[model samples]
Target: MGGAARVRRGAMRFGVERRDRPASERRAERGGTGRSPARRRCVGRPIAKARGMTHSPLRVAVPLGGTDRGRSGLGTWVQAVLPRLARRLRARGGELLAIGTPRDLDAYAAVLGEARPETLPAALDRAGASAGWHLAALGRLARRRGADAVLLPAANRRLSLGGPPTLAVVHDLAELHVRGKYHALRTPYVEHVVPRALRRAAAVVAVSGATRDDLVRHAGLAATAVRVVPNGVDVERFRPGRAPAALRAELRQALGFRGPFVYYPARLELPGKNHLRLLEAFARAARAGALPHHLVLTGSDWGAWARIDARARELGVRERLAWLGRVDAAWVPALVQEADAIAMPGLFEGFGLPALEGLACGTPVACSDTGALPEVVGELGVRFDPRSPEDMARALATALTHPVVRRRAAEEGPAWAARRSWCRTAARLDALLEEIAVAPGKAVAA
Candidate 1:
């Protein structure tokens, strides 16, 4: 556990202040409590009695425009969550509004039948515009709709131009940690804009405690201002016992891999995701006859593909590696089901979704145990040093060779994933919304 221990120690001394919580309780989580009901409906809808209604229910505005596929993990997150949030707001007779281009509006409308989506101004459709311009468009939209609060679900690149209660959900600060992972345009955004946006926000939602700490360390945010609401897994969609034999065969054929294969479903990039080290480890294991399976990587190359491909060839394991770029998201659970094991060696992660999904599907999981990976995987996966190819090779070998560890992963993984439902995650965000919307004076215990 040297690597895991080192990671824990490094995080503790990462120069971020750690507040002492009273041992009596952990008031740690997302959203605020006691959101009292309003006397009226939403702003647009009129009151009767000659209008019997009084004050209107709070309106929450969410922006939803972006391409899915390989473009944005933010897209994936918003697609999964906003619909659920819409349902919750509707149940309370509150309004949930969406602002985006037609593509964005349609995407949300498809899921949220009752969702009120408006196409944004044409200026927002142009690329390379300033974040301030985008925020201005949203502010005008918010004012028109009489929104009480605005949630920037994918607020990594931009901050509010100032309007109603504005909150941003920060997934990770990977740029602060790994400078080379992002492109030039994005480098400035992460370094300058994201921090400013977060600081100016009414409150920021950090997806993990590690991320909350990053907010404090990198962006100089108050620990009290950043709420820790973890990302979640859809257990029913990713659970064990859903892998039918015929569907498994079909998926394997489509992915063009046969026999036993270890899966690493991360985008191909530089040293950030540690794909180079993973290929090195896999090659060494294959050469030593320690590994009997091929390695299937299932994401498009963000950058460094030529280098990664060349390295695989040099390692003499090119044929043993399959570069299945960006398969349909729907195929992920089935792919996890068919894989012999799941190996992740990312240098950092705010939360490791694929690892958790693989575990949910009862697959043996191996990861670098750095950043949020240890907390996300818990005991359901094996941990190794991402910096050491030898350590990673041994961990992968163990996951494939050891019977007891493999058995525990299959038998105990569901329970681990079951505890991390999207509902619970959404509830935390909902609470944070309440706090930001109504109880602006209070600190979020979560």
Candidate 2:
């Protein structure tokens, strides 16, 4: 294993904290006088109480899947939301159990040190098959541990846990609607497994209204079953700031880049993310002398990097292109702060977390008006049709040339970002858990 992987493995040795004991034991350990019957009823028993009863802390099980430790959008949201929910739930006299795959257990433990864990005995490489097995295992585990509710950060093949009512966070219905590309294989999984999971889940949480609509339209889920919970940002983590002088100097010297640069921080996935179209647009802008800025692409995967490099060379703008593959997450805010603008020409997204992150950093953004981009950004940034290079070139040119627009975006963007917070997201999640623990038959909380 590589150094990073080794470090991640070392971190998982420390086991996760779980609330597997009875409610009386938990209350006594915390120095409580006595556990109330209502509290005890709320802990391991089904919800069956008078309306408007005071809420109690619930034993919640959160399952981590898909990029749960990285700086990617989904990972970032999960990292922010889960711990806060755990902390808040604990304060309210409840407990949290975080379930993770054996492969990701270490990475997750590294990020969420004190959260309780129930490690799934399977690898994540085989996502579809592993998800089915893990879900069944999680159901049995939740019942054995007396968990009040279970949550999946991402979708799985099955979620029919015998113990607590289940919930899932569905980012989008991409595999159902968008076919004939890299995601073609996922069509079968999405069509067969996702609907069943949705049906089994008591509540379906979508990251954006667009995603909710997509799920209702394509997956045939009832609108009432889905709740729109937009993704949030860590305002303090990603704010307007200059790059550290030493680090900036080191990176500049290392990359041999000395001009203003347009930054694109996303995976180099083909088809959906559309890195080829971005390369084409950047080359056209460079050739026409319309843009004097260097293009900096920062992400993972060298195979995709080679393809983009060849395209840049074919367009004769290889000298103007720089690839800084996978930088530390701490440096992202500073790098985005230094850029003229952040560009995301993705063809689809569940919530477009990076766009919101860039905006939180007070950087102007130029993204395609596709998928959940418009929903996240609203009128705060510039947009273009992702399918056309000419449109992308025009949007890029506009962002580069218009100082007033950039300034306005910087002035208004942070406040827009401030509207969404992990704290609030957790509170909503807590409310849902309370509802499920009390009355599973009641329609899911709005």
Candidate 3:
């Protein structure tokens, strides 16, 4: 009658296969492992078999948050990983199960068409009230589907499903470390939900070693419990190419821009991104006539757009600023490739994927010297103190003026980006899954 009930029926119908049975035999006789009445039943039979059978398809359940109605950094990461994971798993004779809230189901379904998708109860949307019921429902569903492993694509409340081990990708430990920096509404959610999830996860993957260390130190997670898996770029999609004159013309006309442009491709989040400071820096540079290039701000989330617009006007650089709100995915690579230099002045980040991507497109980068940006950018680009507008202005001026620095960054940046790939990230994930399945005790906190 319900999703969980239907899943239970499916699992009962398919049953568990024996280790001794041939692949064809198992397929032909889809019955529960007919063990002797006197013998004890294996509580994790389906999961054990799923892991033990090297060639057998692994049924992985990946739970996601709501899809990006706005082109958000987190959304971009999800978009990059999910479809790639699905294809890779399918190729290795595995199936994927995408579980998300009703808001996320349609988008996830569209991306992972072949994989089975389950939407959680709509009542779970209420703040702080649905944790118990949500976990219970998720656990039952995962057990019914006999998931080999469950992947939480984003940090949320952890589900203690009895059937499968869980893997959570902690994008950052910003909530734990940078208190009172985010919106008041989010503070309670993070305080209650995130730490509990981190403690319960079988393996915690951080986007950078910096974030991993933060998790270990601040969240009381064991260092050995964490693994550093850096976010990667789509190399094939984001390569250097000539931007069509028509598109350039459109952008110029829309924004009243008639000169070379430097792009800051990120959401207009305050405090965390330090966007107000960035605007001040841009204004300082503009007033000095040091930065001849227009500044383009791309990707604005809800409630953030108006703030950024007001900041631009107040800075007196509204005419020089282009607010390209949520550009198409296909256009992003092209836009990055066309920019003279890509700037990320964020005060903190788990991993600066945009900087990595801009470098991959052979655009020189100028970013902050904080959080994971230094680790991600390495020696490829210029680093500035995000807190100081003067520092940012100076750095932008130098980057724009210095040909030798830009040349070296442009030459070396793509090669750096090329070294990290989604394929490689996925391979590492596969190994982690195997290790967790075979020797789960090894995954215990250090």
Which candidate comes out best when scored by TM-score?
Answer: 2
**lDDT per prediction?**
0.69, 0.69, 0.66
Stronger candidate by TM-score (1 vs 3): 1
**Cα lDDT for residue 44, candidate 2:** 26
Per-residue C-alpha lDDT of model 1 across residues 361-415, encoded as one tens digit per residue:
8898888767777767775677888999977776777677666667878997766
What tens digits encode model 2's per-residue C-alpha lDDT throughout 281-334? 777655544568988888776357778878888888888888777887766776
Model 3 Cα lDDT, one tens digit per residue, 350-410:
8888888887777877788777877777766677888898777766665665565577667
lDDT agreement of model 3 with the native: 0.66
Worst lDDT window (10 residues) for model 1?
Answer: 34-43
The candidate, 1 or 2, that scores higher on TM-score is 2
The CA lDDT at 255 in model 2 is 65
Per-candidate Cα RMSD to the true structure, in Å, reads: 7.4, 12.9, 16.0
